[model samples]
Target: MNGYHILLVEDDSMIGDLLQKMLVREGYQVTWEKDGENVLDIIHQIDLVIMDIMLPGEDGYQVTKKIKNAGLNIPIIFLSARNDIDSKLQGLTIGEDYMIKPFDPRELLLRMKKMLENQYGTFTQIKHVFIDAEHKKVFHRSLHQEVAFTAIERKIFFYLYENRDRTLTKEHFFDYLWQLEDRNPNIVNVHIKKIREKIHDHTGEIIQNIYGEGYRLNTHMKK
Candidate 1:
């Protein structure tokens, strides 16, 4: 499971039901509510929100303001039928994004994923490991224990993760870990060896050695 929870505040039964099902199918936990009522009661449990502008009582904008006023930093995307520029502007100003009704579900889903990743960092399960960029930690899926790392190892791991798929040179690590201090390039190799061992990547599968380039974290590993 993706393991992120979403709060869907949509009054239309058909739309809410369809969205809830799609989100669930995409491996997200969803809480569907018809209106803004009872939002605060369970807002803490929500990781992100899909809001509707028109509702039985308080509108999405008002509800969003209240949530923000309460010092919550949850990301929200306004989904509504209103296509007017004014409505879109207001929604965009208050929420992270705005999607008009009759929108493509695929696009909406993609946006949700990007927003979640941007806000909470890259969280994905790949094979036996769960990389939680937000927490700066990795967990063994079956063992149910965190993959411990040294301070410098953790920094290097996350730096590679945050820049996944892009080969980071040895100089990048030296600059990141100790600025202006020339350190042995082999030190990076040593730390990477331990990191790979801890994460069970003995064959350089996930953390690939790019020949003469450097190292890269390939997060697209099959689950």
Candidate 2:
């Protein structure tokens, strides 16, 4: 919910700024692009793209076509002023979705959510025992306990959840905590212990150590 990254490509300054602000207000991390040329630079980092049909350098169709051809598979929804059948067909055929200009902002948000849900697993479905990335909080229903994380703790849990597919070494956590070359890797152990305590995971260590391999989250993404 909070961490979904969206790419907004619109040439017009006014429209682009407005759309970016709206998307941000809705909790999406919006990356604004003024031209189609810059799409490639941020495409790999974004979850979705909301583009204008008429771009300055390269048109929306051309940019989307290139993205699809590249097999990047990032879903794109065209937000254009061109209200023509041919335009709709071409954009839909080349991209994942399309939406006309002068449309409701709420509807745009809903479509973005749908595209994201279809692409990645739903946020609610992927919850850990007490880790809720969507709401950016932690809670346990059975124990009737809910505790919030500090900024650093939240980052640690989020990173662990995202990379739960494999064991995460202490070095991986050290890199996230500080840019300082002198930061000690032992700090990872301290924080990991704190996270375990806060979540009341005393009996079962959900994020268990993998012996020589560091650590891994013993949780699976719910289908």
Candidate 3:
């Protein structure tokens, strides 16, 4: 939730400064661009985009087409003063959400939070560890370090994180690892052991081992 990078494309200095300050204070890393230039250069790193219709060069709609054509699925929100029906329809057609100028900052924050949750899912925290499943990254808040995982370890952890609180059978993991040459059921145990060690869940508190069931990433350990 804290590390979401946002691209704010607005030419108005007043609005851009206000939004940049607000977004940063709300725990977002923001990049303010006066126009549609250099979007593709950093599009992959951007989690969401706040676009303004009126700009110095290519309009918001045109920039949106470039983004879409680049094959990236980054969500865009149009924040423009043009609140007419035609503009709204056009904005909503290409962008995910459209908001008019002179809008409430609080409402914008709420809408942004909702949109981000819907797009990338809310973060899952287990003890001092925070899981960003969509971005495939985990951070240890206590130590202020990213928890590294091997490719297989990351896959297994992601699977468990995606289905947190649900019991995923060994067969589920086996089916997941079907493509691997070594489809041994014990591989799940090995990877889970490594994952638990990396996350410092030595007592199986975060990743629980059900006696009859398979395994479940217990969200109750978040406390």
Candidate 4:
């Protein structure tokens, strides 16, 4: 919950600055963008967007439409000077929460908090054994257990856990394990084998291979 990234797209410099200050004071990582054009570029990095209805180049409605068309599910809140029903309806039609201008900064912050809460709620840390990404320490119900993991083994484990139910391709593994640099697919297979052995020794559950696709943590198969 530390430093949740927020993208604020406001044409007014003063309002955007104030919003950034308020969010930063509340311990949020704020990325303020004044134009609507560059919004899509940074959309992936932010958890949510605080958008103004009237923006330069493209209006908020058009921006929101494009975002939805692109299949991005990030929550958006519309802050605009237009307080008419039509404006509110338009914003809501495009899947945005509309708030009038001259609103209190604290209240705006609260609205943003509410939207985020409704979307992601409060995430509870999973209480299970996991190899710590940074320290490489194995954690089992708050107890630190010693476990050795090679660089590639750690990468593969983290990738699989990050994408739990989804089947990852060998290309995806190669990209993450070896970056954009070329590497043999056998390297991915070797790392997968090693990871399976370690996880099996500890938990006795196999990371299932999907024949042609890749691997998955088979939650249906109990440890």
Candidate closest to the true structure, highest TM-score: 3
For candidate 4, give the lDDT of residue 131. Answer: 42
Candidate that beats the other on lDDT, 1 or 3, i.e. the better one? 1
Task: Please give the RMSD to the true structure for each candidate, in Å.
Answer: 7.1, 12.5, 6.8, 13.3
Q: Name the 10 consecutive residues with the lowest summed lDDT in model 4.
A: 138-147
Full candidate order by TM-score, most accurate first: 3, 1, 2, 4
Q: Which regions of candidate 1 fall more than 4 Å away from where they truly are?
A: 126-129, 133-135, 138-223
Better structure of 1 and 2 per TM-score: 1
TM-scores of all models? 0.62, 0.59, 0.65, 0.56
Candidate 2 deviant stretches above 4 angstroms? 124-223
lDDT of 1 by residue, 53-92 (tens): 9999999999999999999999999999999999999999
Per-residue lDDT of 1-223 in model 3, one digit per residue for the tens?
3757899999999999999999988877799999999998988878899999999889999999999999998889999999799999999999999999889999999989999889877776677677877689887652136788888888888898889899999988888866656768677788899999898889998889987779999887535
lDDT of 2 by residue, 1-223 (tens): 3556788889899998899889888867778988888788768877889988898888989998888888898889998888899999998998888888899988988888888878864543223344457767665431124466788988888788788767998778778767676877677778878888877666435777787778776676441
Instruction: Please name the candidate that would achieve the greatest lDDT relative to the true structure.
Output: 1
Give per-candidate clash totals: 0, 0, 0, 0
lDDT ranking of the models? 1, 3, 2, 4
Q: What range of 10 consecutive residues in model 2 has the weakest lDDT sum?
A: 121-130
After superposing all C-alphas onto the true structure, candidate 4 shows an RMSD in angstroms of 13.3
